[model samples]
Target: MAVLSLKKSNLPSVWLFSFQVIFLALFVGLKFQTGYDWPIYEAHYAAIQRGESFYLDFEFGYEWIVQVASRVGLAFEQFSAVVSVLEVAFIAIAVRHFFPRYCLVVMAVMYSVPDFYLIPTFSLLRQGLAVSIFLIGVCKVFSGKKISGLVYFTIACSLHYSVIGGVFLLGLVYIFPLSRMTFSLIFAAAVVLYVASFDIIRGVVEVLIVYVDPKYMIYLDRDVFNASFAYRAAFAVVSLVIFTCIYSAWMRRESSDGDHFDRGFGLLSYRLALLGVLIPLIIFGFPTLSTRYQYFFAIFVIGCSLGALQYVNYASRIMVVAVIAVTAYLPFYRFLSSPLSIVYIPYQSQLFYDQTNSTGHDRTNDLLNQLDVLWSK
Candidate 1:
């Protein structure tokens, strides 16, 4: 929780800063036809352009963006770029406000965790934007601007209804202000439930079905629970272990010149990280819910993990960073080598559009075709 001065010497090196800028530029300017969900969104944009009815599958804020972009005559690529810029801007603002000295480290850690970066920004576009704005709201709330935080949370939920879960969790945490020990006990219980293969959450989901939209029932389909459950559960557990190490080191360090607000924010972040880890286990049967919501909490996990680095001794810091780097890299490498890599690898940009030799576009089409075949089966 120590607050480092914003001195030039304390900032990230020029090379690191330049690399981040360049990487962000490429990320924002990504080709519209390359990402996993781009085709669906592009189709919706085309529908809007053709004067068709707006796609109700997405939330109103996203539909509004499409309509405005279509009316303005912007290409789908341009619209996508605009959204990416906004997403990055929101994330940058939040990171700078909260962890100014660790901006590079935070970005590095986030990138290392594919779900935190690639899956969200490159695939779940609407949810990505919502999460980014939600992060800003978290900053506002922690800074004592509760009303402004509420407004941001409202807008985020409007953009992606799935974000309502995150809002609800944030509200619970703010009101109750759980201690680290409570989060640990909750996480341990969740892990036990997951290990037992308990379906208690099914009861909760069934109750929700009565009050929530019927369309959401699709997520409860038996086919949704597959081998990915174990994989995602393991991932969450590993991340929780990593967070426990960082937090323990943070807790052991002597108190610094940090005020009550700084210390409180760190504790809050640790609790949020614990909540993030518990989420996948708490909703074990719902694979889609586990996958999507974990990323929402990962924003906090990454921040809290990196922020705690300042408090640890040099040896412990190095060890934690090394573990994080390895853990982060393994998933990233596996992702790029996985069959799903067709959706993201061979990165393409709108700046170099080619009608005949669009490898990325062609690969994405092939992947989507395979998905259609699988779904039909």
Candidate 2:
């Protein structure tokens, strides 16, 4: 078995696999006590059962994956649990297989995002499958299988239209090469998009109001989007600078032609990574577009984190220990506290529930109840 092979190769794949299993297991087991956003997932289950498709702007090709997994089990939650666990596992495998040196980094990124935990908590049926499909595409891209990557991405889009952002970003990889000028344009565009998110949201709201009643506006309101701040924007700017510098330095250090394909198709992967950061800013900067934007950001972050990990110092064997330690601890330290807990966040529950109060208790309870109802039905 792959798990037993850990004693043989000493590959980083073992570590990545171990992390996903432990983290995802904890996420599944601690749903109630942690008070993660189980309610949203629970609602998603209901939506799927009722056949209310995800946004029509794109397609999610993994509809069969969700249905098959869901149908294989006796209960909805059981199926959701199975699919969710598989997602973490699949991504883990992909990370190990393609980006071996950055395996731990991929785990760290996935776990660091609070929503990663939340999505599976209540059981987001289609979206969960969509995420899994997206990871499949990532694996394909890194493994030098562009056709398969496109197919997987298409599957993801059919499951959730939001995944179209991923497809578009992936397509960008085929366009211009990553350069100082491209970085400048991206940074400038991020700034403009961040500032204009409000206007964009207003326009969207007006368009929606024309079709639906104004009272339905409450549907757009949620706590998840409330956390958007100037710090996020600052982080984007910093990441852009860091990535640009890293790419420049890495390019300078390279001695060989390397793989024309890696550098060529890898351009799309890099673009996808950048879009992952920028799209979130536009979505979260304005409260109205926060929830929808988060979906995009979540997908984007997974790709961005994977790409970013490659440029780090882990190319040397001596740095592997430090890489694992840093990747593992970063999520725990940054997210395992009040307002940063995984309960509210997703993968960092140890912190989220630590600072729990009556309100947290009630919210958690409400979400659990809803989840139970959806599963029972």
What does each candidate score in C-alpha RMSD? 4.1, 8.2
What count of clashes does model 2 give?
A: 19
lDDT accuracy of residue 15 in candidate 1: 63
TM-score of each: 0.83, 0.61
lDDT of 2 by residue, 1-377 (tens): 22222232345556546855677555754444334544454454455666686542223244455455445542444554565666666656655554454455455555555445444333355565676677788778766798998898877778777677656655565555565457657667766766444436546765787688977654444322432345445445545554453344335334233566345344444445455455555555343234334444343344344343334443442353344334434424334553434335333233344434324445566656664664454
Model 1, span 1-377: residue lDDT tens: 11222223466654665467457846755655677888788888899899987455788788887889899999888888888878877876676676666676676666556667777888788998999899889888888898999999989988898888988887787668876667777777777777667768887888889688987776665424443555556656575666575466446532453455445555676677767767767876886677688877775666666655666565676666677667656546556666756887777777776566677667877887876765666
Off by over 4 Å in 2: 1-16, 19-26, 29-73, 115-125, 141-147, 176-178, 192-264, 286-361, 364-377
| Model 2 C-alpha RMSD to native | 8.2
Return the number of clashes found in candidate 1: 0
TM-score of 2: 0.61
How well does candidate 1 match the true structure in TM-score terms?
Answer: 0.83
List ranges where model 1 is wrong by over 4 Å. 1-9, 13-22, 55-57, 195-199, 206-213, 222-225, 228-237, 253-266, 333-337, 359-362, 372-377
